[model samples]
Target: MSIQLIHAMNDLTATHKDLLELSKRKTEALTNNKLDEFQALLLEEQKLIRQLEKQEQKRQEAAEAWKDEQHHPAETLTITEILGRLDVEEQKMAEDAAVALTDTIRELKRQEHLNKALLEESMKFVQLSMELVNPSIQSMNYGTASSDKMSGRSLFDSKA
Candidate 1:
């Protein structure tokens, strides 16, 4: 049982590592405005989330089993509490998994925060450019400008 618990922890750790790598790639894609690449990364991220959810379920089951064997209540337990119920060797495995997952998640969050800021800046720049090109239009009234009204396209559209 403890061995199974260790395996679950290992799986969770591996998933978190994969997510960290994907998050970095996502950051790059967002920063470069690579819409196609960003869409692909989002799909991959969704699959990873599914795997992570499965792993979490396995871990929770393991925790419940350990708690039961120890005669503890059947309440939901934190990872730390579950680790306490594990044997020495299994405890080490759980601890390592916890630490690795935590660190990877932290780094992923930092990169994602940076990517969000970059996206916001890019949107702001696009808005400023639109305002510059069509000073007569306020709040994107396409009919306000003669060129916009005639072409039925944005000022930034090359074909317009």
Candidate 2:
């Protein structure tokens, strides 16, 4: 395996694990009324997701290049016929690659969407489970607020 490919795969897996941890953090933060931390972790996860996507793109590019090389025109021919025949085969191969890339891009995009949804659903389950366990830790309002003046603001608001 390519060093870059290996690193990319490792990074992607690490990022996914980080995202899972962030989801857990969000659940805890919401339970403890620390919405700020929850939002911060969510943002970090989003950033990591974007990075992971970029790495995926790079991997795809490398794979496409390898496929292109594999379909190169057959070696050896009459010196005169070589250039013309090579051009034809190269064009055919390129067209084939274009079609393959389009299909693969669509499929990968769909998979990415599904992965996002799965993570979101998992987070929802976490939040719901926390609710079930404590039953009073709070919903989305965090810990609740006093009725005093300048109160009832978002949980993210400064306490001091």
TM-score of 2: 0.40
Runs off by more than 4 Å, candidate 2: 1-3, 72-160
Question: What are the per-model C-alpha RMSD values against the true structure?
Answer: 10.1, 16.2
Give the per-residue Cα lDDT of candidate 2 at 148: 48
Clashing residue pairs for model 1 = none
List model 1 lDDT by residue over 1-160, tens digit each: 6677777878887898898889889888877879899889999999999999999899878867777777877566677777777778778877887787778778878887887888798889999997788775455555546464567655487865
lDDT of 2 by residue, 33-83 (tens): 676886797788789779878877876555444335545353432223322
Model 1 lDDT at residue 81 = 76
Scored by TM-score, the top model is 1
Cα-based lDDT for every prediction: 0.81, 0.56
- Residue 73 lDDT, candidate 1, scale 0-100: 75
